[model samples]
Target: MKNQVTTIYKQAERFAEITKSAIVSGNIVRAKKCLALAERLFATGSYETKNAISNVYVFSVSTFMELRHCNISNLFPQSLKAEYLKQINTSGV
Candidate 1:
Protein backbone atom coordinates (compact mmCIF):
# COMPACT_ATOMS: atom_id res chain seq x y z
CA MET A 1 0.00 0.00 0.00
CA LYS A 2 2.82 2.37 0.89
CA ASN A 3 4.59 1.71 -2.37
CA GLN A 4 1.38 2.11 -4.29
CA VAL A 5 0.66 5.41 -2.63
CA THR A 6 4.21 6.57 -3.28
CA THR A 7 3.92 5.65 -6.93
CA ILE A 8 0.57 7.43 -7.18
CA TYR A 9 2.03 10.52 -5.55
CA LYS A 10 4.93 10.59 -7.95
CA GLN A 11 2.66 10.04 -10.91
CA ALA A 12 0.34 12.78 -9.70
CA GLU A 13 3.29 15.14 -9.51
CA ARG A 14 4.34 14.21 -13.01
CA PHE A 15 0.80 14.65 -14.24
CA ALA A 16 0.64 18.05 -12.61
CA GLU A 17 3.86 19.04 -14.36
CA ILE A 18 2.61 17.68 -17.64
CA THR A 19 -0.66 19.57 -17.20
CA LYS A 20 1.15 22.86 -16.69
CA SER A 21 3.45 22.25 -19.63
CA ALA A 22 0.56 21.28 -21.84
CA ILE A 23 -1.38 24.40 -20.90
CA VAL A 24 1.66 26.61 -21.49
CA SER A 25 2.14 24.93 -24.87
CA GLY A 26 -1.54 25.47 -25.72
CA ASN A 27 -2.37 21.78 -25.61
CA ILE A 28 -5.53 21.94 -23.48
CA VAL A 29 -6.64 18.45 -24.43
CA ARG A 30 -3.44 16.84 -23.20
CA ALA A 31 -3.58 18.96 -20.09
CA LYS A 32 -7.08 17.70 -19.38
CA LYS A 33 -5.89 14.11 -19.69
CA CYS A 34 -3.04 14.77 -17.28
CA LEU A 35 -5.39 16.43 -14.80
CA ALA A 36 -7.75 13.48 -14.96
CA LEU A 37 -4.90 11.07 -14.30
CA ALA A 38 -3.71 13.10 -11.37
CA GLU A 39 -7.21 13.24 -9.89
CA ARG A 40 -7.58 9.49 -10.25
CA LEU A 41 -4.29 8.92 -8.49
CA PHE A 42 -5.31 11.22 -5.69
CA ALA A 43 -8.58 9.40 -5.25
CA THR A 44 -6.84 6.01 -5.05
CA GLY A 45 -4.08 7.09 -2.71
CA SER A 46 -4.19 7.07 1.11
CA TYR A 47 -5.42 10.01 3.11
CA GLU A 48 -2.02 11.41 3.91
CA THR A 49 -0.80 10.75 0.42
CA LYS A 50 -3.83 12.44 -1.05
CA ASN A 51 -3.37 15.36 1.28
CA ALA A 52 0.17 15.82 0.07
CA ILE A 53 -0.90 15.56 -3.54
CA SER A 54 -3.77 18.02 -3.19
CA ASN A 55 -1.61 20.96 -4.15
CA VAL A 56 -0.72 19.24 -7.40
CA TYR A 57 -4.40 19.06 -8.25
CA VAL A 58 -4.87 22.69 -7.30
CA PHE A 59 -2.01 23.82 -9.47
CA SER A 60 -3.24 21.72 -12.39
CA VAL A 61 -6.71 23.25 -12.14
CA SER A 62 -5.26 26.72 -11.87
CA THR A 63 -3.28 26.18 -15.05
CA PHE A 64 -6.39 24.97 -16.79
CA MET A 65 -8.38 27.97 -15.60
CA GLU A 66 -5.67 30.32 -16.72
CA LEU A 67 -5.61 28.65 -20.09
CA ARG A 68 -9.36 29.13 -20.33
CA HIS A 69 -8.96 32.80 -19.51
CA CYS A 70 -10.64 32.39 -16.14
CA ASN A 71 -9.33 33.46 -12.78
CA ILE A 72 -8.95 31.00 -9.91
CA SER A 73 -10.23 33.56 -7.46
CA ASN A 74 -13.39 34.08 -9.49
CA LEU A 75 -14.30 30.45 -9.13
CA PHE A 76 -15.50 31.21 -5.60
CA PRO A 77 -17.70 34.18 -6.56
CA GLN A 78 -18.07 37.06 -4.04
CA SER A 79 -15.50 39.83 -4.44
CA LEU A 80 -13.19 37.49 -6.27
CA LYS A 81 -15.63 37.47 -9.13
CA ALA A 82 -14.90 41.13 -9.62
CA GLU A 83 -11.21 40.36 -9.92
CA TYR A 84 -11.89 37.75 -12.54
CA LEU A 85 -14.22 40.10 -14.36
CA LYS A 86 -11.46 42.66 -14.48
CA GLN A 87 -9.15 40.11 -15.99
CA ILE A 88 -11.76 39.16 -18.54
CA ASN A 89 -12.30 42.76 -19.48
CA THR A 90 -8.58 43.45 -19.86
CA SER A 91 -7.86 40.20 -21.71
CA GLY A 92 -10.54 40.98 -24.30
CA VAL A 93 -11.19 37.33 -24.86
Candidate 2:
Protein backbone atom coordinates (compact mmCIF):
# COMPACT_ATOMS: atom_id res chain seq x y z
CA MET A 1 0.00 0.00 0.00
CA LYS A 2 2.77 2.41 0.86
CA ASN A 3 4.64 1.70 -2.35
CA GLN A 4 1.54 1.96 -4.44
CA VAL A 5 0.64 5.27 -2.86
CA THR A 6 4.08 6.66 -3.54
CA THR A 7 4.05 5.45 -7.12
CA ILE A 8 0.64 6.86 -7.82
CA TYR A 9 1.59 10.17 -6.26
CA LYS A 10 4.68 10.48 -8.42
CA GLN A 11 2.84 9.52 -11.59
CA ALA A 12 0.12 12.00 -10.80
CA GLU A 13 2.72 14.67 -10.27
CA ARG A 14 4.20 14.05 -13.70
CA PHE A 15 0.78 14.01 -15.26
CA ALA A 16 0.00 17.30 -13.56
CA GLU A 17 3.12 18.83 -15.05
CA ILE A 18 2.20 17.63 -18.53
CA THR A 19 -1.29 18.92 -17.94
CA LYS A 20 0.02 22.36 -17.11
CA SER A 21 2.16 22.41 -20.21
CA ALA A 22 -0.75 21.30 -22.31
CA ILE A 23 -2.84 24.09 -20.87
CA VAL A 24 -0.16 26.66 -21.66
CA SER A 25 0.37 25.33 -25.16
CA GLY A 26 -3.38 25.42 -25.82
CA ASN A 27 -3.54 21.68 -26.15
CA ILE A 28 -6.83 21.06 -24.44
CA VAL A 29 -7.07 17.53 -25.74
CA ARG A 30 -3.79 16.48 -24.25
CA ALA A 31 -4.55 18.28 -21.05
CA LYS A 32 -7.84 16.48 -20.69
CA LYS A 33 -6.24 13.16 -21.47
CA CYS A 34 -3.61 13.60 -18.80
CA LEU A 35 -6.17 14.85 -16.35
CA ALA A 36 -8.34 11.85 -17.01
CA LEU A 37 -5.40 9.57 -16.40
CA ALA A 38 -4.58 11.36 -13.20
CA GLU A 39 -8.17 11.02 -12.09
CA ARG A 40 -8.05 7.33 -12.77
CA LEU A 41 -4.84 7.03 -10.81
CA PHE A 42 -6.43 8.99 -8.02
CA ALA A 43 -8.47 5.93 -7.24
CA THR A 44 -5.61 3.94 -5.78
CA GLY A 45 -3.71 6.47 -3.74
CA SER A 46 -3.80 7.02 -0.01
CA TYR A 47 -6.15 9.66 1.30
CA GLU A 48 -3.47 12.30 1.66
CA THR A 49 -1.99 11.55 -1.72
CA LYS A 50 -5.38 11.74 -3.33
CA ASN A 51 -6.10 15.10 -1.75
CA ALA A 52 -2.76 16.55 -2.81
CA ILE A 53 -3.15 15.41 -6.38
CA SER A 54 -6.73 16.58 -6.45
CA ASN A 55 -5.61 20.02 -5.36
CA VAL A 56 -2.94 20.18 -8.03
CA TYR A 57 -5.29 18.93 -10.72
CA VAL A 58 -8.07 21.29 -9.78
CA PHE A 59 -5.82 24.30 -9.41
CA SER A 60 -3.97 23.70 -12.67
CA VAL A 61 -7.07 23.19 -14.78
CA SER A 62 -9.18 25.77 -13.03
CA THR A 63 -6.50 28.41 -13.43
CA PHE A 64 -6.25 27.70 -17.12
CA MET A 65 -9.99 27.97 -17.50
CA GLU A 66 -10.08 31.21 -15.52
CA LEU A 67 -7.41 32.69 -17.76
CA ARG A 68 -9.50 31.80 -20.76
CA HIS A 69 -12.44 33.74 -19.34
CA CYS A 70 -14.28 30.54 -18.72
CA ASN A 71 -16.36 29.73 -15.72
CA ILE A 72 -14.25 27.44 -13.57
CA SER A 73 -17.36 25.60 -12.52
CA ASN A 74 -17.87 24.63 -16.13
CA LEU A 75 -14.60 22.78 -16.16
CA PHE A 76 -16.58 19.67 -15.39
CA PRO A 77 -20.27 19.39 -15.16
CA GLN A 78 -21.21 17.81 -11.81
CA SER A 79 -23.09 14.92 -13.37
CA LEU A 80 -20.40 14.28 -15.93
CA LYS A 81 -17.70 14.44 -13.30
CA ALA A 82 -19.47 11.83 -11.21
CA GLU A 83 -20.06 9.57 -14.19
CA TYR A 84 -16.53 9.81 -15.46
CA LEU A 85 -15.08 9.16 -12.03
CA LYS A 86 -17.23 6.08 -11.71
CA GLN A 87 -16.35 4.81 -15.16
CA ILE A 88 -12.63 5.51 -14.90
CA ASN A 89 -12.31 4.02 -11.43
CA THR A 90 -14.09 0.88 -12.51
CA SER A 91 -12.40 0.56 -15.91
CA GLY A 92 -8.95 1.02 -14.33
CA VAL A 93 -7.73 2.64 -17.54
Candidate 3:
Protein backbone atom coordinates (compact mmCIF):
# COMPACT_ATOMS: atom_id res chain seq x y z
CA MET A 1 0.00 0.00 0.00
CA LYS A 2 2.82 2.37 0.81
CA ASN A 3 4.51 1.65 -2.47
CA GLN A 4 1.32 2.10 -4.43
CA VAL A 5 0.62 5.41 -2.76
CA THR A 6 4.11 6.61 -3.43
CA THR A 7 3.82 5.61 -7.05
CA ILE A 8 0.54 7.45 -7.41
CA TYR A 9 2.04 10.57 -5.86
CA LYS A 10 4.93 10.43 -8.27
CA GLN A 11 2.57 10.06 -11.19
CA ALA A 12 0.66 13.08 -10.01
CA GLU A 13 3.88 15.05 -9.84
CA ARG A 14 4.70 14.14 -13.42
CA PHE A 15 1.24 15.12 -14.50
CA ALA A 16 1.65 18.43 -12.73
CA GLU A 17 4.85 19.10 -14.63
CA ILE A 18 3.19 18.26 -17.90
CA THR A 19 0.31 20.48 -16.98
CA LYS A 20 2.65 23.38 -16.33
CA SER A 21 4.28 22.92 -19.70
CA ALA A 22 0.98 22.68 -21.47
CA ILE A 23 -0.22 25.87 -19.84
CA VAL A 24 2.97 27.67 -20.75
CA SER A 25 2.58 26.56 -24.33
CA GLY A 26 -0.98 27.91 -24.34
CA ASN A 27 -2.51 24.47 -24.89
CA ILE A 28 -5.44 24.93 -22.54
CA VAL A 29 -7.12 21.68 -23.57
CA ARG A 30 -4.05 19.60 -22.89
CA ALA A 31 -3.40 21.42 -19.65
CA LYS A 32 -6.94 20.83 -18.43
CA LYS A 33 -6.72 17.13 -19.32
CA CYS A 34 -3.43 16.76 -17.50
CA LEU A 35 -4.80 18.59 -14.46
CA ALA A 36 -7.83 16.32 -14.37
CA LEU A 37 -5.67 13.22 -14.51
CA ALA A 38 -3.44 14.57 -11.78
CA GLU A 39 -6.42 15.41 -9.61
CA ARG A 40 -7.86 11.91 -10.08
CA LEU A 41 -4.56 10.33 -9.12
CA PHE A 42 -4.35 12.53 -6.07
CA ALA A 43 -7.89 11.65 -5.05
CA THR A 44 -7.19 7.91 -5.25
CA GLY A 45 -4.25 8.03 -2.87
CA SER A 46 -4.08 7.24 0.80
CA TYR A 47 -3.91 9.98 3.40
CA GLU A 48 -0.17 9.68 3.62
CA THR A 49 0.16 9.92 -0.11
CA LYS A 50 -2.12 12.91 -0.26
CA ASN A 51 -0.09 14.66 2.38
CA ALA A 52 3.11 13.91 0.53
CA ILE A 53 1.76 15.34 -2.68
CA SER A 54 -0.17 18.22 -1.27
CA ASN A 55 2.23 20.77 -2.68
CA VAL A 56 1.91 19.33 -6.14
CA TYR A 57 -1.83 19.22 -5.89
CA VAL A 58 -2.00 22.79 -4.70
CA PHE A 59 0.33 23.94 -7.43
CA SER A 60 -1.73 22.20 -10.09
CA VAL A 61 -4.93 23.73 -8.82
CA SER A 62 -3.43 27.19 -8.57
CA THR A 63 -2.01 26.96 -12.08
CA PHE A 64 -5.35 25.88 -13.43
CA MET A 65 -7.02 28.86 -11.82
CA GLU A 66 -4.37 31.22 -13.10
CA LEU A 67 -4.77 29.94 -16.62
CA ARG A 68 -8.49 30.09 -16.42
CA HIS A 69 -8.52 33.65 -15.16
CA CYS A 70 -5.62 35.12 -17.07
CA ASN A 71 -4.97 33.27 -20.29
CA ILE A 72 -7.87 31.03 -21.21
CA SER A 73 -11.04 32.36 -19.70
CA ASN A 74 -12.84 31.51 -22.89
CA LEU A 75 -11.48 28.01 -22.90
CA PHE A 76 -12.80 27.53 -19.39
CA PRO A 77 -16.25 28.97 -19.12
CA GLN A 78 -17.57 30.47 -15.90
CA SER A 79 -19.65 27.39 -15.12
CA LEU A 80 -16.67 25.08 -15.50
CA LYS A 81 -14.53 27.32 -13.34
CA ALA A 82 -17.21 27.38 -10.70
CA GLU A 83 -17.36 23.61 -10.71
CA TYR A 84 -13.63 23.37 -10.27
CA LEU A 85 -13.74 25.94 -7.53
CA LYS A 86 -16.37 23.91 -5.76
CA GLN A 87 -14.27 20.82 -6.06
CA ILE A 88 -11.31 22.62 -4.57
CA ASN A 89 -13.39 23.94 -1.73
CA THR A 90 -15.02 20.61 -0.93
CA SER A 91 -11.77 18.68 -1.22
CA GLY A 92 -10.32 20.91 1.49
CA VAL A 93 -7.16 21.53 -0.41
Candidate 4:
Protein backbone atom coordinates (compact mmCIF):
# COMPACT_ATOMS: atom_id res chain seq x y z
CA MET A 1 0.00 0.00 0.00
CA LYS A 2 2.79 2.38 0.93
CA ASN A 3 4.70 1.60 -2.24
CA GLN A 4 1.63 2.14 -4.34
CA VAL A 5 0.90 5.47 -2.70
CA THR A 6 4.47 6.66 -3.13
CA THR A 7 4.62 5.60 -6.74
CA ILE A 8 1.34 7.31 -7.57
CA TYR A 9 2.43 10.55 -5.93
CA LYS A 10 5.70 10.57 -7.85
CA GLN A 11 3.98 9.78 -11.11
CA ALA A 12 1.34 12.46 -10.53
CA GLU A 13 4.04 15.02 -9.82
CA ARG A 14 5.84 14.07 -12.98
CA PHE A 15 2.64 14.35 -14.91
CA ALA A 16 1.96 17.76 -13.46
CA GLU A 17 5.46 18.89 -14.41
CA ILE A 18 5.00 17.66 -17.93
CA THR A 19 1.64 19.36 -18.14
CA LYS A 20 3.14 22.60 -16.93
CA SER A 21 5.85 22.37 -19.52
CA ALA A 22 3.31 21.65 -22.19
CA ILE A 23 1.27 24.68 -21.21
CA VAL A 24 4.31 26.96 -21.13
CA SER A 25 5.57 25.69 -24.45
CA GLY A 26 2.17 26.17 -26.11
CA ASN A 27 1.87 22.48 -26.90
CA ILE A 28 -1.74 21.42 -26.45
CA VAL A 29 -0.95 17.92 -27.66
CA ARG A 30 1.69 17.48 -25.00
CA ALA A 31 -0.69 18.85 -22.40
CA LYS A 32 -3.33 16.37 -23.46
CA LYS A 33 -0.76 13.59 -23.26
CA CYS A 34 0.06 14.62 -19.71
CA LEU A 35 -3.63 14.66 -18.83
CA ALA A 36 -3.99 11.19 -20.30
CA LEU A 37 -1.01 10.00 -18.29
CA ALA A 38 -2.59 11.43 -15.17
CA GLU A 39 -5.89 9.75 -15.93
CA ARG A 40 -4.13 6.43 -16.41
CA LEU A 41 -2.31 6.85 -13.12
CA PHE A 42 -5.58 7.55 -11.35
CA ALA A 43 -7.36 4.63 -12.95
CA THR A 44 -4.54 2.21 -12.22
CA GLY A 45 -4.12 3.28 -8.63
CA SER A 46 -7.86 3.47 -8.10
CA TYR A 47 -8.11 -0.20 -8.95
CA GLU A 48 -6.10 -0.97 -5.83
CA THR A 49 -8.58 0.60 -3.38
CA LYS A 50 -11.43 3.08 -2.98
CA ASN A 51 -9.32 5.36 -0.83
CA ALA A 52 -6.57 5.35 -3.38
CA ILE A 53 -9.03 6.27 -6.05
CA SER A 54 -10.35 9.23 -4.09
CA ASN A 55 -6.86 10.49 -3.31
CA VAL A 56 -5.77 10.19 -6.90
CA TYR A 57 -8.91 12.00 -7.98
CA VAL A 58 -8.18 14.84 -5.63
CA PHE A 59 -4.55 14.98 -6.71
CA SER A 60 -5.47 14.98 -10.39
CA VAL A 61 -8.12 17.68 -10.04
CA SER A 62 -5.93 19.83 -7.84
CA THR A 63 -2.97 19.42 -10.15
CA PHE A 64 -5.07 20.33 -13.15
CA MET A 65 -6.43 23.44 -11.43
CA GLU A 66 -2.92 24.42 -10.40
CA LEU A 67 -1.61 23.89 -13.88
CA ARG A 68 -4.37 25.99 -15.38
CA HIS A 69 -3.90 28.75 -12.84
CA CYS A 70 -7.39 28.26 -11.47
CA ASN A 71 -8.54 28.49 -7.88
CA ILE A 72 -9.04 25.14 -6.17
CA SER A 73 -11.40 26.69 -3.67
CA ASN A 74 -13.69 27.78 -6.42
CA LEU A 75 -13.81 24.35 -8.03
CA PHE A 76 -14.90 21.94 -5.30
CA PRO A 77 -17.28 22.21 -2.41
CA GLN A 78 -16.38 21.90 1.25
CA SER A 79 -17.84 18.42 1.59
CA LEU A 80 -15.73 17.06 -1.24
CA LYS A 81 -12.71 18.82 0.18
CA ALA A 82 -13.28 17.19 3.54
CA GLU A 83 -13.66 13.79 2.03
CA TYR A 84 -10.53 14.20 -0.05
CA LEU A 85 -8.65 15.45 3.00
CA LYS A 86 -9.71 12.37 4.91
CA GLN A 87 -8.44 10.13 2.14
CA ILE A 88 -5.21 12.07 1.85
CA ASN A 89 -4.50 12.01 5.55
CA THR A 90 -5.17 8.32 5.85
CA SER A 91 -3.59 7.23 2.57
CA GLY A 92 -0.42 9.32 2.66
CA VAL A 93 -0.30 9.90 -1.09
Candidate 2's error at 31, in angstroms? 1.0
Q: Between candidates 2 and 3, which one is better according to lDDT?
A: 2
Relative to the true structure, candidate 3 has a C-alpha RMSD (angstroms) of 6.7
Which window of ten consecutive residues has the lowest lDDT sum in model 2?
A: 71-80
lDDT of 4 by residue, 28-89 (tens): 67766655554455545455533443455456656566667865464344544555566456
Best-performing candidate as measured by TM-score: 2
Query: Between 1 and 4, whose TM-score is larger?
Result: 1
| Candidate 2 runs further than 4 Å off | 1-14, 71-93
- Models 1 onward score TM values of 0.48, 0.52, 0.48, 0.43
How do the residues 6-90 of candidate 3 rate in per-residue lDDT, one tens digit apiece?
A: 4655766665677677877878789777655545545676876555446555446566657657553444434334544654577
TM-score pick, better of 1 and 2: 2
Residues 51-79, candidate 2: write the lDDT tens digits.
Answer: 65665555555555667785434445353
Clashing pairs in model 4? none
In order, candidate lDDTs are: 0.56, 0.59, 0.58, 0.55
Compared with the true structure, the alpha-carbon lDDT of candidate 1 equals 0.56
Clashing residue pairs, backbone N/CA/C < 3 A, model 1: none
Candidate 3 achieves a global lDDT of: 0.58
lDDT of residue 9 for candidate 2: 48
Predicted structure 2: lDDT: 0.59
Residue 45 lDDT in candidate 3: 62
